[model samples]
Target: MLAESPPETEQSAPPPVARPRHAARAAGLLIALAVLALVAVASIAVGAKPMSLDEVWHGLFHYSGTVNDVVVRDLRVPRTVLGVLVGLGLGLSGAVMQALTRNPLAEPGILGVNAGAAAAVVSAISFFGAATLDEFIWWAFLGAAVVSAAVYALGGSRSATPVRLALAGTAATAALVGYINAVQLMDTKALDKLRFWTVGSLASATMDTVEQVAPFLLLGVVLALTLGRPLNAMAMGDDTARALGAHLTRTRILSMTAITLLCGAATAACGPIAFVGLMVPHLARLVTGPDMRWVLAYSAVLSPVLLLGADVIGRVVTRPSELQVGIVTALIGGPVFIYLVRRKRMAQL
Candidate 1:
């Protein structure tokens, strides 16, 4: 009788890939890391002033407060470090979000973090007279955190579904973006202060900014990398995920927490960079297949490459006058967005 009662218990788990495929994926991941390292070096050495390799080396290891040293040590170094951190954060958050929502277009912004941070930063400049990057960063993080919590609650809290969360985020983003526009238009004096922050850039980064964001970024990275298993189960559908003993509610909560940490710190550090989150995960999934674990690994490694590469291009394209990294990424991300929309069915999660 006990044996006969188990007919319904035979649902299969997602099958593992063959060992050969695993080895190939691992090789690709290592190559991605190599690209990331090279991009980071380019970020430090190829800014507007264009330091040489020797200068970059001395700036990192030996410093004498010379002009080149200052440029290398004080400016490009922080920018490069922040770029990598922000890129990693965005990539991981994006990949995790797509996995959580099972929506091809899901990104960190889908939770309203970008809108929330923007609104808060605007308010700080317009209402609170917060003029410095220091002031805006704190307000941005606070706003992102609060709005994310609100969106979670609005989305149904413990019982939240992907559709509900997406709807809630859209609603919240619309409301906050409207508020930001009204405030900025009414208070044109604040526009100058808000303009660069809103559009996003890493030019304002300092060592202090790096210190402020490192802890949250590290924690978020760890949390996200660990979610590959449950997220993989989740990809198999909710009923199947439950059958596989995945803790759906806890996973959702943790996922949101990681997003808030990663996206909030990243936005606060360097405004809100676009497309790194939106596009990087899709690219990662393309290379790593549908396996959430490998996709996440690739996303983490490759996201920084896209971001810092964009940052370097932004520096060189305009000669003495550089474009913002945000602008550069937008220019790139727009075509990708169109391509995604035109496709009949996007590459699966």
Candidate 2:
């Protein structure tokens, strides 16, 4: 018995483990925010009629010098605000769309939201001669809603597949573009208006236009944020989500509504700007991982950075003459899109 007791076996313990990765992600997000702030300031200060740092400071708060004050307050400030709104809307909507469809390439522009809004605007201009921003805004909103509903109805089954949604979106986009082209061919006056708006310049932005669309954008943003957790749950497939107590159909419908409002307001404000929606979400995901919370936050900050930076570049590249923000985004986003496709990663969605 004593000999048997002496032969007690030794036991082993598990190795020490690493801390959670979320803390590191939180730190990175803080850094990203700081960088975004710096870029925003640079965007505000370095416009066509270059303002010194001191002038920017005074203009923002104190308000001195007629020219500096007007430039900063009237022109740059409104444009920058719109940029922030548009970026937030596009980024958040893109995130929701991607999550809902489980597709990385899904964006309002790519999925016919922009095309729908644009078609509506074109029809408004061609048929009704609606020249005011307010008139066009309503039409754009209606068009966006219709197209979004169509996309969902066609592509969303008991289990919504990304490929089917994409195909439906593509078909809708093609039809809308064809309609626009036909109108442009027939009506030179409408073509003139469409030519400028289609390129997406922020130059025409005014306080009135900003005010008109701000409520819609704000509502959409709030909905998108609230839906983030649900969307994350939904990404695990509809059946799994249902088992997890998530309402699949309700979530999809609400998400689509939010996208319609966000995309509609953005398109109404800045005419059919492409690629920001598509590019910003992917870029945000790369930085913040797959979490919708982080993705939306990064998008809010980064989208304005891209849109405003593009706008500033547009102002400077041609000096007295300026390129459109839409053109700039297209030039940059098109190549990036191709690269993503060539890399074979985007197709995984």
Candidate 3:
């Protein structure tokens, strides 16, 4: 017994648990940036008219008074810039909406925000004769805010579930769409003006328009990025989020404000471009995991890449008569949406 007691063995420590690798995420971010740069250059160079890469470089860095330079500087440049800004806004807004509603399908286009803005702008055009985007910007902002508030109210208070939110969004969007069609039917002049706005194009992009919406876009982006932590908390269930000391009311209000600013400004600039919000967030999440901060970052970068790339494709595909970016995005997004649905990821919301 004394000999057996002398043979006690020692225990070893457990192996360290492995954390998720971030190098891949960083690489993905870099890849997105590279693609965005390439797409921006392609957007400038590969328009309906032929232009050399040298010309594009000169137009960007060293400008001379030439027709090619003018086209690059005046037309494509503004359009490309607007595309980037709008894409960023829409992409971030979509991620925010999904996080807020805890529904993957939630987006500005789906939630009646764009429809409300469209309705308001048409109302302003037909009734007030607001001919300029500058005049109608306020109308768009007001409409977006009102509709968002209405959706939240109908959806539920602080503890609204995703199903109720989605249902409320669908109902509001349908009602607004019907009203928009009625208004357009009544006023042919308004219809003519609304055609381009409703279709969504960067063709009419001007520096003035860029300047007008820049402030809103910048503010929205900053606010959205700041909300990453709160959003992450929210993704874990409302009770858990509250336990983590996340302010639900404040988060909701700020998130709604950010969405309004982003979507209203974007819809005003380039009609209601659908699917960017829906598609971009999904792609971003695939790269960034379930972390809202990384998801938002990836969405902001990749969205512009998709948007500008689509615009370039639209420009090159038709040759003489170019397709609008909205149409192009729809064509691309429809298949992607179908694929996602088939994958059964939609139910994961």
The per-model lDDT (C-alpha) reads 0.83, 0.81, 0.85
Ranking by TM-score: 3, 2, 1
User: If both were scored by TM-score, which would come out higher, candidate 1 or candidate 2?
Assistant: 2
| Tens-digit per-residue lDDT, 1-349, candidate 2 | 4554333343343333323466676777787668767766766787777668888888888876688987887778788888878878888888888887787667787788889998999999999998988888889989998887787678784455666877888899899989988998898988877887876878877788899999999999998888877877776767788888998889988898888889888988888888888898788778767778778777877777788889889878887778888899989988876665466446433
Better of 1 and 3 by TM-score: 3
TM-score of 3: 0.89
Worst 10 residues of 3 by lDDT: 10-19
TM-score computed on alpha carbons, candidate 2: 0.87
- Model 3 residue 212 CA deviation (Å) reads 0.8
Q: Between prediction 1 and prediction 3, which has the larger lDDT?
A: 3
**Alpha carbon RMSD to native, model 2:** 5.2
Q: Which pairs of residues collide in candidate 2?
A: none
lDDT of 3 by residue, 1-349 (tens): 4554332333343333323347678788898899999888788888988788898888877889788888899999999999999999989999998998887777787677887887788788889999987877788888999988888788885666656876787799899878888888999978878887886788889898999998999899999989999999988887999999999989988999999999889988888787888899988887778889889999999889988988888888898778998888889887875676466546534
Q: Write the per-residue lDDT of candidate 1 for residues 234-346, one digit (tens) a residue.
A: 98888999999999999988998888788878887787777788798888777887888998899998889998999999999998878999899989987986677578765
lDDT over C-alpha atoms for residue 211 of model 3: 94
Once superposed on the true structure, which residue ranges of model 3 sit more than 4 Å away at CA?
Answer: 1-20, 156-164, 339-349
